[model samples]
Target: MTQGRSIRLFLVDGTPNGLLTAEIMNWTGHVLTGPRSKLSELVQRPECGRTGIYFLVGPDPDNSLRPLVYIGESDDVGTRLKQHNRPEDKGGKDFWEKVCLVTSKDQNLTKAHVKYLESLLIQNAGQVGRCKLINGTAHEYINLPESDRADMAFFMEQIRTVLPVLGLDFLRESFGNKAKAEPSDDAGVDSPRLYMQITKQGIQASAQEYEGEFIVMQGSTTRVDWVAQPGGYGALFAQLCEEGVLSEPEGKVRRFTKDFAFSSPSAAGAIVAGYNVNGRTTWKVDGSGITYGEWQDRQVSAAAAAAAAPE
Candidate 1:
């Protein structure tokens, strides 16, 4: 029989039998011991059936309850409490990490009751500088209707209070901001420079680029007249299909289903390569054998040479 926090020693029917014993210590640890009897024994006991939320507060060497942790709820408070003090389960270290179950007198420990108690603890835990409630049992209770469950609202509030402490800024940011109307003066600037449209039929891509201060058009459409470029330009066409840019078909092959549109030759090349196509080897500059990559390089070199020339 190990001593625990607050011992309760007594005799059974005038025979010196250790009916129950509990040890209570400040920060060291605590335990409770009793004979293995039927659940009826605990039910019949006057001190049994203790129900409610239990707080596991401990000193952080400074002997202050400022950094308490752990909150728990139990229908069978006494049994849960005993489990916390058992030596088998890491000496109750897991229970004390966030919450602990203590003896409660609430016999009819309904789901609502447990939720309400957990919520109260969560709310208070934040104020007391305790860790955030990592447990999900609190939220489970909130799903119940208030009419059916009295503790739903209480738990929600507690959850709200602790959410900030847990550094859940992403959730707060997402829910806090409301979408506003788009601002004016966003005409040409707002237009998508690239478009990848999916349809049920097939994929198509178009590109427009400035060449020597003149706009040149290049693209691939459903028209078979468009010359098929070599290398992996076909891959971009393939990607359009994979990306669902093409319309959904009942039973036809879904390959080459999507369409891509870009304003810059480089952008189109990038889109092709990014989607796993060899743009350099695939697309050709005009009817020449020069690849997209070779064309881009020549353009860059020409620009650099012109810039370095006198002026």
Candidate 2:
């Protein structure tokens, strides 16, 4: 079971897409996120001067389905961000659209502390296979004292907790059992829902609605090769293979090595079924014959009725 978190968010510019700061209750770590447009404004803040690990995130032009990430650690995060702000011709990271940095509010983090964090982040983010990492090679981890390692580990925990709230999902690591996202509060945990897809290829899979995506569980078999090669699902399927999300353990058929997330149920079904298909109609609730479309309609109808009910 996952415990609830206490986090406070501040909109520095009072706009949704502008610079933002985040804090976890009783934690020393501070997180900052903002558009690349506000680099100067962000670096001027006090926390940016501290030792920390930072991520440059943006959509991949080649794979619109996934974000591209570049991770780095610096003694003075402010200076490094400015260097990244340099023009593309000057070796700046041109692919970055937004920036996020993790630093300690108490300024107690040291050089060795952040290096370990940076190294672990790179390794795990690659394994998560969510983002397209632009970092060429993983940084080798620096050794830390026993107590220091424990502290850095805790600090890393806080970083993972707050990142998802900032709209970064680079740490969803899945290997054996399938990467399952904690049922987030905003995913309408107010209701419990499940859907099933039965493909003509004898593919039988179950999925649950999570956050805004439908996560097909691991062990779900997918066509070893996409029959088509020219559309969004095909592109996404190929990217997943490249990222190591889907693997072949047995025959020529590919299986989801972990619970994989899709933008919609149809997207999941399309990839699993090896062709284009309507997800809403393809997936159904087990035991009941109702399709996902019908189930969604029922949910909406219930909300309307409850909203219209007199107090």
Candidate 3:
């Protein structure tokens, strides 16, 4: 018996007969074999049957003192082990996908034992994303005898010992910590300065600015609908409202004071256009008319030309 070592047990399921083989690994990476026990032998023979728990220890590559997987009870432990080791199944991958099964040959397993097995699975499976529980009843060939309480208890205990060495405990702890640190709704709303609004019509937007050009605001909800340019335009409108030149009603068009004046012809032209207006086409810089789409193309071309130019 190896102290503080991890073991991997595979139980094969079969009708009327089953075999349980445990692969034990020690701390130094050595593998040891345990006595193979038959399901009938465990149930029929009192002395051998009383040996409900089996331990095999081997070296853990990741230096953890827990079994990678556990099986509670099954009618055919060998068959169940074969299913896990089969390459055709998604559960078959080795090393990357660590799995275990705890099962009993007794069909009439006690509810208490089933629950105990479930708890053990939950604790360890939370660590390995691939943990699963398969009902023996689903397989017609593997008929477990009813009311086998002793076998069920033995199976449950076997699973618990193997879980920690398999690194399942470490994973569960990591996941718990991650869940606690995740962001919440209150945290988001607390920073009003980082927020921006988007109109339902998908025209207006609000954004931050940098060096004479608009910088899209980080974490702005306005970007959900409106494009960058539209968002910037909405931000400009908001700035106007702040400056007292325009007043925006909750659900209506932005209104300018009767005495308010535009500093640029483009600004006046934009006002003349309808609600949800595309300002680039409505407004003009000089005598030339340009749409926002065209302006974006021009910017892309300028950037490309600068990149192509030699140092």
Candidate 4:
């Protein structure tokens, strides 16, 4: 098991959504986050003038599930942020609404150091595939001493740990890395934790609960087109296709290219079944003929009854 970690978060104006700073216990790096409207105040902070790597985060207008991110670095992040706050015609980046910057508390990052960090973060963000990156061209290489590169890589991991806690998840790695003791293929020893089916059309899928997401695993059989009634499910199917999460390899028969997360089990079911169906009722054990909702309720009731029994 992993050891517990301690982090301190400080709200500058005593508001939950306002400018905030975070630091892990015993870490030399500091994280600062705030809305674009608060950039002036953020720039006023002492560390804002330090060389650092920063992330500009905002929504992707075309897709609600994918965030829009712009990763950058600067010798003086404060000045760069000020420039981005200006009008687009004046060299500003209008797409971003929030900013998160990582700087050392000791103000040790140099220009080359931040550039290296910027490039690494950009590459990782692209591989994660959770967001739409807005960088014009990739910044690929930055020379650094071997020792410093190792230190910076460790620093990057700590930043990754803190970022999602602050609601900036564009830097998160892909879900494939989390799956263990199970391979995505159907012929494997470990099958999906749950199965949802549309038996008539021979449409079925393997899914599992993952980090609060109902993830339909890879190789799950799905429809190539949105064959369901025109409604929310249709919209979702179209979006999934547009995002390339679901694709047809042999034509008219879709396979999940990557694991996809649905807001709820029902949503996951609808996408896999190609219909506006009830997930709790549609998903079941292979031969149990019992609904997921019923199974869950039974387990809950049994646990309560067991707890109530006098020890």
Candidate 5:
């Protein structure tokens, strides 16, 4: 079982959308985030003057479903941010609308430490493939001692945990670290496997629910043509197609090129069926024929019965 963690967040401007700072209890890292509009205020904070790694985040102009990210490190993040805030003609990026910076609260991070972190962050973001990276190439750093590397690795883990709480999930892995697109036999040890089939259309897809995410496994097939109403799933499918998650039409059907994680079962089902669908009722247990909704209800009822029973 996972242990619960306590995180402290302060809204620097007393507004949800304004500058904010986050700290995990007992952790030495400090995270500060704010919108590009708040750059003037953000740069004024002393934390921005320290050695740290920062992320510039925004929507991808071409792919609506994914974000574009730029990972960088600096001895003085405030100055670097200001330079990036300049006009595009002056070598600034126009796509990023928000910034998230990670610095050590203890002031122990140095130029070398941040550079090592930046490289790893860039590499990890690329491996996750949840965002489009604008960085040219990650620079290498091999000077850190083995002990420092171990410490930085722990710091990186904390960043991973806090970022999703702030609604940044590009570093979150959708498919568990296997390079294989198909689900392995041990894939469902922690979660139940579900399947969706449309015999009439020859559509057959497999999925699994894990940690609140619905993952559509690879090799799932779907209709090549869009039969549903415009927008919503149609828009999302187009974006997935653009991102190469789904392959191009090879006749009347297209296939999932990789396992993609969706926020809900309906979202995954919609992409598979090429339209809106009630995923709860459509996705059934791999062999039992019980709907996802039914299986969920059964689990809840079992837990309730156990709770109401003997001490």
Candidate 6:
């Protein structure tokens, strides 16, 4: 069973778009985030002077869904940020539009601790493959004591819990069974594994909706050649091919080599059918044969009824 956590968020300037701070109850780590335009104000916060790890984030020029990220650590984050705020020709980055920094409220984090955290964060981000990492190789930090390593691991877990709440999900791993996302709301009842197919082309696929993402399972079949004009779906299909997520065709059909998550079922349907599709109407619940759209509509109506019931 998963336990609930309490996180507090504060808008420093009392505006939704300005700088913000986040902290989790019982955790020593603190997080500060804001747009690059607010870099001057962010650097002035006392937390910026502490040793910490920071992330620079911006949209990928090629894939809007996957962002470009750079991770680093510094003894004095404020000074490091000032340097990064410089013009690109003066050794600063031009691609990042927002910045997020993590430090400890107790002021116990040292240069070594943050270096270790940065390395782990970089490694995890690479394994997740959710974003393009712009940093060079992560440096090794093996000299830290075993006890300190355990503590840092726990600290990283807290960071994982908080980041997603702030709309940063680059660190969230994609493997559904191993993911840390909250369980389904119906008392841990798992969603049914739904199926979709294009009979004429012999295409067959299975997927499950988990924590809002629709994951197309491994071994699902797709067309060898996409028939639609290159749009967002087309671009994503090309990306999947380039990343080798789709195996070489065995005949007229290609297979998903591993489980891949899509932002919506429609997007998954677009790739599986090799063209645009309304996944809600196309995908059917296994055994029951009910359309995904109908099942989702039932759930929505049930929730609305429950909300309107007298107490």
Lowest-sum lDDT 10-residue window in model 6: 182-191
In model 6, state the lDDT of residue 157. Answer: 87
Stretches of candidate 2 off by over 4 Å are 173-203, 210-212, 218-258, 273-281, 286-311
What would you estimate as the lDDT of candidate 4? 0.81
User: Can you tell me which runs of candidate 5 are displaced by over 4 Å?
Assistant: 178-190
Stronger candidate by lDDT (2 vs 3):
2
State the displacement of the C-alpha of residue 64, model 1, in Å, after optimal TM-score superposition.
4.6
Q: For candidate 2, report its TM-score.
A: 0.76
> Which stretch of 10 consecutive residues in model 5 shows the poorest summed lDDT?
181-190
lDDT of each: 0.39, 0.80, 0.35, 0.81, 0.88, 0.88
Q: How high is each candidate's TM-score?
A: 0.28, 0.76, 0.23, 0.85, 0.94, 0.88
Q: Which order, best to worst by lDDT?
A: 6, 5, 4, 2, 1, 3
Backbone clash total, candidate 6? 0
lDDT of 3 at 89: 52
Q: What is the lDDT of residue 188 in candidate 6?
A: 38
CA lDDT, candidate 5, residue 287: 78
Clashes found in each candidate (C-alpha, N, C closer than 3 A): 36, 2, 40, 0, 0, 0
Angstrom error at residue 181, model 3: 14
Q: Which of the two candidates, 1 or 5, achieves a greater lDDT against the reference?
A: 5
TM-score (C-alpha) between model 6 and the true structure: 0.88
